[model samples]
Target: MNIIGGPAQDGEWPWQIALMWNNIYVCSAALLTPDWAVTTAQCVNQEASGYSILIGTNNLAEWSPNYQRQPVASVYKHPEYNTRIHDFDVALLRLTDPVEITDYSRTICIPTTDMSFEVGTTCYASGWGSSDGINEFLQEAQFSITSSNNCEGVTSNMLCADGIESSGACAGDEGGPLVSLVDTRWYLVGLTSKTTCGSGADVFTRMTAMYEWIAPILDGETPLSK
Candidate 1:
């Protein structure tokens, strides 16, 4: 629970999803479209077929078995995703069944081709990672906006946030959304990719860089967001 302000208050921009595996592999993911979900490839790469997506709820305890357990129909890992160097760690999952879009469930807005955030823009990240800096079963977590320039030493696809060493996403938060407030709505700017572990920076896959790959899928021309 890497909460910055406090435990996630009940109704904050609720487009969150939980990727579950054997009732143990729990990680938060974001719905990018009715048919696609944006999450870290590492989260599902190991057991792609065994995973289930839980949408339309934030409180896991209240989630029911009937709550939309969509099977992952397909997974599109970024061609550049390399675990050794963590180059492009993002991936897209195509649901076996398209989720019904309602007031509580909707696709998040991706940054337009021209829109971007600078080195200093503030952004917020949320997930169900550990709360006490130790890995635990997934729990609600939050963190304040950190800057991007702090990750100059890593791959260009990775961005950084503020915090000395106490803030940022932890394990189990992988594949979650790194949101940026813009124009009165939060835009999907990055996908939680990795954390330095001991460092404060939580690296994310730059969504803008993969706009070309995700465009066809988002536009319905391609079957997957490759």
Candidate 2:
């Protein structure tokens, strides 16, 4: 995915992932753990058998020595997800096998309930999707979290970020991570719901708002886990 403005540094986005369905890039995902990831429900629309997760590399063509590929064991989309409104658009993924979490490959911390981000806090959205189309390298854009009222379509459960003309998600960034650096850790704040390509406001499903549905699953218990 192209950052619209430029490319991401090697290992800069260790938690970024390239998700494929039938060997073709479909969406972006964030590594919450070696065996688990988070994305948008809209992205998990197909069967798990055809899904593939690629990790540990910024450039798809140039495989980083520690790069790994794994199949999806299971997927759980939010029961309340509404496609028309794009509400509650979160999903949890179980990797067939856990990857080795290292400096070159790692997980992004999930935002806790108590952590609060202000309306003007700076955050980032990264993916392999470019403004023109899909690309081989990872790309990122910086945005200041805006208020829900700033956009007519945004709700309290979603976050809005006004994109600078050439700095936002596009064609392939859906289900990717929207993170903010908190102290020394990068906390995943949201999952991309859609891309505005940086011309306007970008949308995301707020992670903290979905914590109740995600907590039990992260604890390894969910009706869909069956």
Highest TM-score against the true fold, candidate: 2
lDDT, each prediction: 0.68, 0.81
lDDT of 1 at 208: 81
lDDT of 1: 0.68
Off by over 4 Å in 1: 64-67, 131-149, 163-165, 196-199, 223-226
Model 1 per-residue lDDT tens digits across residues 106-203: 67887765777776676777666754543322333344445655665566676665533366666767787877778788888777777644356677
Per-model clash counts, in order, read 6, 4
How many pairs in model 2 have backbone atoms within 3 A of each other, for residues 3 or more apart or on separate chains, i.e. clashes?
A: 4
The number of the candidate with the highest lDDT is 2
Estimated TM-score for each candidate: 0.83, 0.93
Model 2 stretches astray by more than 4 angstroms = 223-226
